[model samples]
Target: MRVSQTNLAGDLLLNLEKQGAGPLHERVKRALRLAIREGRVEVGTVLPPSRQLAADLGCSRWAVTEAYGQLVAEGYLEARSGSATRVRWSNAPDTDVARPSARQAPAARFDLAPGLPDLRAFPRRRWADAVRAQVTQAEFTELGYPPAGGHLRLRRLLAEYLGRSRGVSTTAQDVTVCTSVTDGVRRMCHILRAQGITAVGCEEPGWTRLRQVIHAAGLEPVPIRMDHGGLRIDDLAGRPGLRAVLTAPAHQFPLGTVLVPERRAALLDWARGVDGVVLEDDYDAEFRYDRRPVAAVQGMDPSRVVLFKSLSKTLSPALGIGWVVAPPRWTRQLHQTDQVVAQPSTVDQLAFAALLESGTYDRHLRACRQRYRQRRDTLVQALADQLPGAPISGIAAGLHLILELPATVDTAAVVAAAAARSLRVADLAAYHATDARAAHGLVLGYGNLADSGLQEAVRHLRGAIEGSS
Candidate 1:
């Protein structure tokens, strides 16, 4: 029997005629499954309300409900109460087949992935000692839900640490603990949205996943351009209704250019003129290879900039701890938001605080910084030896360097070739917006790679590029 198709509310409508069907409910279910299988209802696409769909299809709501129930049970659709049902992608084979049990895989080796510090170097013994002391001395109530902002001891320690190291002047009251930098940005976005601001500027060729998070928060991600010296402040000027600007000024992500003095001043001037908030992400600010690290922008204008830093790059990403120092005006709002969302783990915070108090953390930072500097130098030398004339940026700071390639070399193809060779590398173009005219390159992370592995990885990368070309 021929079925009539109808366009309803920009969604594809399926019309199935009764044709010797045993049950109407089964027929409806079959039709919906066919539609989904045929790619009519795309994955993650929301379907019309069940009631609305039932009414349009001349069937009782129960029929539509049952069909939706079957689809959900089969993993073809996801039904969240009070939320519209969405088509779920089921193309990927059962992940368990390829994913080894965390126990089965040996400990991670040669982690060339950026944003990870030396886990082996973490002071586990010191942390254990601190945990023992804290638990022994603490009252039973100390184990209760922590203050939404953070433990006062940890906050105070973080304030002093940031103030001394990064030159960010903030009190314990101005500091709020967050799960990570992304969490802080999300909370900040909510606060800004409540204040009637819906758009924020993100650096182009910046942290790709963080930009996605801003968009996921229902805010516009205005891609601001970036050059060798960090974000292009000129591109941000005169942009209307821009509520906030998220930046990694200390050591710019993907392209590790320190925000120059002139640009930093210009950025502050622009933020003050537009009444915009600047989020200073001091990501990997502690591991400068050659010179002293640049002081955070938040240090220059405490009122206008919110400073964020995490131990993820300094110690380990598993240590889900980061601190944010906001202006006095935002402190209360951020604290309230933190309370609404559960606060970070108290044990981890106390352990971190103990690490800082014992001076062990600083010692580790010094040793790791020296090791990473050596590794960075070795990687740069290897790159120069293997891929001579390749423009290398972001060598001064951070664990990674950007190896810019000729426009003729397709970065996507190179990445595919690298993957085939069991070499993992990030494509620089993936960080930019579709319309952005940014240079294509690879972000080579040398922090986790041993000296030997670093040389081998560079050789593989060179081979990948050649094969791709």
Candidate 2:
């Protein structure tokens, strides 16, 4: 009983040490205080003696003594010279020791989210084979901490993969792997801000996540409006002080408009004139249903554009794999960002490389492109048949299309009505950064729904929109 008691206290102290930095005494004090406040150290629970705790932590006995004394002064723990110390405070909430898990969003019978894929079609067996190959073939040296950039072979393969598939011009040396497009955006913002960039312009009806990245990096996000030709380059002329801009030039999110050729050239010229940079988010460019998607803008000027592509949409987000093909000037900084903060997961990096090397990754993509094309076609036909005169747009070359509703339609009301009927849908108003450019519409994602399921969802959706309008 005595031995088990001492070991319990020792284990707690050791776990606490790993949490933060400071003098040993201060960390010990903070950890114990939190434990008591949170009721982990329940009131009247006996604590280990200072000498035992010091030996457990490999710290001087005085450090433990000081920590206990400080807590005693704060009335968190009580110590009687002849008796063991006990927790004296109990300010914790009256509830379970662990809080209930976060509430999940209500699951809709028919989910039409823009960010999802046909999860049922994920290449599980191919992925398992890749993982097995990695374990059997990997060297002992590969087990250690991953490289600052990532697994070198994986970066090389991804560089080649992007060139073949997306026409992104780059050598293996220019690629830096990240967990997702969001991760790449954050690192780019940090590096650019470090280089004295004060602000960046993003497409107005752009992704909300991109705006969050800008805010997190302490750089201001200026919402640049878009039109039929895509983001207005002329509007950027007024903000000459802006140092960078982010675009999805191949196919803009939600609206699904491609950046026209003239604007693409002018936007590049603007970046060059201001000595600025462009971050191209090539998110779902892989699953263009109608035609072969346009090549990335990074090919136009590798020195000026940083292209971000991720497997989250193409393969599975569970893999958490992505890369940023940066200009030469920013390559070293982007690589160092992962090294300094959080390193990439080596196992995921390795499996992705194995998939690429064996041609399984490309094969999976070809299969997915076909499957997604069928889904897109099914969605278009279902809408045209069941929900006629819906005014569909953006079906030219993306996984999902947009439906522009009349200005009188209450987009939010339509979304609520759909949700009430157990159908998931999105309002375009939520995508806008500022009220100035907010449009009333629905950004319906169809790459995941099945034949009958999609037909049923659209019929319900049409009723919802009509009822709300």
Off by over 4 Å in 2: 3-100, 103-106, 338-341
Expressed as tens digits, the lDDT of each residue in 1-469 for candidate 2 is 0111222443443355444887778877887787666656666677888898777666778988999999999987788879998777777563223233346555688878788777777888888888887878889899788887678899899888888888889988889888889999999999989999988899988899989988999999999999888889999988869969999998898888899899999989998999999889996787776578788989999999999988877777877888899987888888888455555578778988988888987788789888877878888888889767778887876667887788989999999999988888888888898888545689898766665688889989998999998
148-230, model 1: which lDDT tens digit per residue? 68899999998898889889888999999988888888888878888877888988878887888788888899988888778
How many collisions per candidate?
0, 0
TM values, all candidates: 0.76, 0.79
**CA deviation > 4 Å runs, candidate 1:** 1-110, 338-341
Candidate No. with top lDDT: 2
**What pairs collide in candidate 1?**
none
Worst 10 contiguous positions by lDDT, candidate 2: 1-10
* Predicted structure with the largest TM-score when compared to the true one: 2
